[model samples]
Target chain A: MRGAGNRYVFWAVALAAALAAPLALTNNYQLGVAHQALIFALLATGYNLLLGFTGLVSFGHIALFAIGAYASAILVVTFGAPFLVGVGAAAIIAGLVGVVIAMPALRIKGHYLTLLTLALGEVIRLLIRSMESLTHGSQGFSGIPRPEIFGMSFRAGVPLYYLLLFALVLGVAFVWRIEATRYGRAFKAVRDSEIGAEVCGVRTDHVKVLAFGVSAVFAGVAGSLYAHTMRFISPEFFSLGLTITLLAMVLIGGRGTVIGPIVGAILLISLPEWLRFVKDYYLILFGLAIWLCAIALPDGLAGAAARLLQARNSVRGRASLRT
Target chain B: MVELLSVRDVGKTFGGLKALDGVSFGLAKGEVLGLVGPNGSGKSTMINVLSGVYRPDGGDVRLDGRSLVGAKPSAIAAAGLSRTFQNLQIFGGLSVRENVLVGRDCRLRSGMLGGVFGLGGSLREEREAKSLAADLLEKVGLARFVDAPPSMLSYGQRRLLEVARALAADPKVLMLDEPCAGQSQAEADALAVLIRALAKTGIAVIVIEHNMRFVMNLVDRIVALNFGRKIAEGTPEAIRGDEAVIEAYLGRRGHAERR
Candidate 1:
């Protein structure tokens, strides 16, 4: 399963879903859920690049995501830029914000950095909330343009769903390529040990900055898609809750692994929707489940599954030896 | 003979204690200088100051006649000086080969965008670096342990791996802080030979060690330190007979059982 065959199977399943999702679910409600899930997938993957691979966490990721969305939203709403340009602008703006935030926090470690980033995010939220003239205050800006291209308006949820799926594919591919390269090795070196990396002549400052920038770019892209899909923008959307959910997806899927984030996003985002029958107690049960999973399977779903599969394979090997 | 590295009255203080005070030394091209002292002698601190780990309170360090006092650690490394820590600072989660690869950070030409696209030039550079790292590993007798992580290697093997990693930087001057700290007699002999061979390549080497026998055999000249002050600087034979050197090593302890 660790070979090309496994990758083929994964891509086949993903492709089938991308093609059939719109056909099977014509209702706007279902399409909306699918679209939102894709956006979450992007956010969760971006978080995975930091939390899983580099062993750095930023509670301010939501703020960077919000900054991207706001930047893009402002461009489209006020300046009338093209949709693609808005997305690019969002990524660059978010990446620059990442550099500013990572500079101070990179010098510190553990909870100090965590708290600093969280406070930074809170500061961004406050600024957004108080800027009555620019950000429209707490009510937020409405009538955001839908994701459109070549004069074909993405007016329906089904079209938006396809757009998000395409984005998810591109994002996943980019991450996969990064994981296989030398830059990825440098990032891993920084995460494993800072002094060790520096002694080896690694400019850890550059590595951390690059990781932050790339992760921010992805988060920004996700945020842009979220704004467009909803056709609305708000300070309420990029909350602490969303940040926690994004982290949960990374942890649950297994941090550091490429496909793990996708698995995490799909399960966590879709699970609550499928459990609507127990809507009243849904959050309580979900939290309990996450707590239990974290304690029992700390490496996340991917690690647990790999362990189980290895055990089964070992047992089979023993059986074959006996024969 | 031009000095490739110079330290001028560098001083470091830890609160009420002065770890290093008014310590000055110079390393000429291809010189194998041994730094020897008893416990709390500041031999390691001198190396730390040169490597930019600790900024000196009172003086300066110059590499190739250029001042490097307040430069960052990476900047110091990039300026053609590399070092190995007394405690094995090899990346534990990385393989031995990968550990060496990290040491080649300054040598790598591939940048962010080049690596992101996996372009031909970057891939070629990566392959070339890997080959060079492999060659260095073989030279240090770590060829078989190429894929083994630091956590899996023995203490002596880890010590050798640190030297191999340092060599990966291709530095003009290499400082080894106690390269023979936790090694056996056989390992120490082998390392002493390796240090001599490295010095033969015309790269200045500074070795910090408490093992008098190893340093005596490996170094051409020895610089002895006591409480951050130089007591004697001469040939290994000359320093061995110096009264201050004996006093530094045998303080309160009888000189009978000393090696």
Candidate 2:
């Protein structure tokens, strides 16, 4: 298939599937899990822009996610702002913070950079905790109102699912568009060789900072959705474990490709719940699965799938030529 | 007749060691200059300084009479100076075409908003860049491997790809550090043809190499360095026959004994 035509078909199918999900799963609990998965998918898609394309490992993404969530909650619940304003604020605030963090974090790379971002994550958490009057400290925030647009409350169930689904589609489309542009090529170039990129006339520093800011915007938007959906916000929700899980999502999905993180997010989000019957062994199995993904499938499930599809197509093309 | 690039008494020091000291050379438009020296004689350092990878501690670099001192690599590149590294700096993960497309990045005007929105201006620019990348790959004789990753390319091919990528910047001055390193004689000859062709287009080409035969045949003029200082500068034949040049290549005692 031609690239553009195939892409349109893929989007159509993905859209139909997403729209039909609520009807197919009827159960509110399943829809809720799906909703959470969509939010995570959005986060992973954004995070992949930095990790997969730009080759920056950041453990501080969870902080951006937290900022978005807290920003939305504080604006909506405390100030009685409209849900849309809160969401927009969340995205802008997170993006600005991302730029600030990246200014220092991008100076160092590899293990040292990773360690720096880790410290940054802890710092954001500490700041939030210490601002007791504003954030209620470790006790967290609750009673976050459901998102409303034109007086239609998306409190739960199908409405929330559809809303999250729409956001996920927009997020995926946004990332897909970026991947096809010159900026995407620059990101990949910087990731591949910073020196080469510099020689090629790319300001790698600017590109890195832009990538961080863009990635934060995605996380922030997802976090806003997550806050409204969950109707609660807390520091614990953005813990180190959440960061690790997001890292796993990107890794397990495949780093550079569009569908990789979404696939990883969906599978990892639902996997533990499906294995809940196994009780204590579920966590152990989940850990082992991630390890196996790292070792056995170095490119992750999406990458593996892409390779398989390419092989099949080539084989078919060869067969037709022989005939 | 116009000088495209001039290096004036440039100096660089790292701790106790002087990497480049008072190195000066001028390159004219449509000229091919060879910079040759033994390992660690500051050949690569000179290229780095010229390309803005290292800031000169003293003196200045000028392109078309504009000072390039203390400019960042990207800024230098934008000012029409582009270089390939001694160690291949190709984007290993990107395809051959994409590698060259990155070279046109400095010329591109589209930003994040344009990219996200896929506006007409950005799309048109992207189409032009892709075609330019394709044209550059063809010029370097790597069109057939346009989709292949750098990892799949041979060392010589990677070197050629690096040249193609650098050329995509459409630089006025192109510095290639050991471009023919580790290549077969035939491969080196192909590179020589490409260098001559690029120079004919009025680019000031600087080829840095230890391969005497390759550089001797490729460049119109030669500059020889030893211990971070120029020992000879003249026609390739003149430099090849100069006693200092011979001594720099061979030891002074060895050359004296031969004499």
| Candidate No. with top DockQ | 2
lDDT of 2 by residue, B154-223 (tens): 8988898989889988999999998887778888888899899888889989989878888888899998
Q: Which stretches of candidate 2 lie over 4 Å from their true place?
A: A1-8, A313-323, B256-259
Against the unseen true structure, what C-alpha lDDT does each candidate score? 0.84, 0.89
lDDT (Cα, tens digit) per residue for candidate 1, span B84-201: 9887787765688888888887788877777768775988888888899899889888899887667777888888888888888888899999888888999899888887788889
lDDT of model 1 at position B80: 82
Q: Residue A304 of candidate 1: its Cα lDDT?
A: 91
Error of 1 at A115 (Å): 1.6
Model 2, C-alpha of A18: deviation from truth (Å): 1.9
Write candidate 1's Cα lDDT for A1-323 as tens digits: 35468768977887897788788876778777888888888888887777887778889999988887887888887788878887999999988988888897668988888989999998998898788687787899787899767787776777778788889888888888776565676778888877767767788888888888889999889888887888788898778998888888888888877778888888888888899999879989879978987899888898798779769878999999999
Roughly what TM-score does model 2 have, to 2 decimal places? 0.96
User: Alpha-carbon error at A275 in model 2, in Å?
Assistant: 0.8
Looking at candidate 1 chain B, the ten consecutive residues that score lowest on lDDT are B250-259
- Tell how far residue B206 is off in model 2, in angstroms: 0.2
Least accurate 10 contiguous residues by lDDT in model 2 chain B: B250-259
TM-score of each: 0.90, 0.96
How well does candidate 2 score on lDDT at residue A299?
Answer: 89
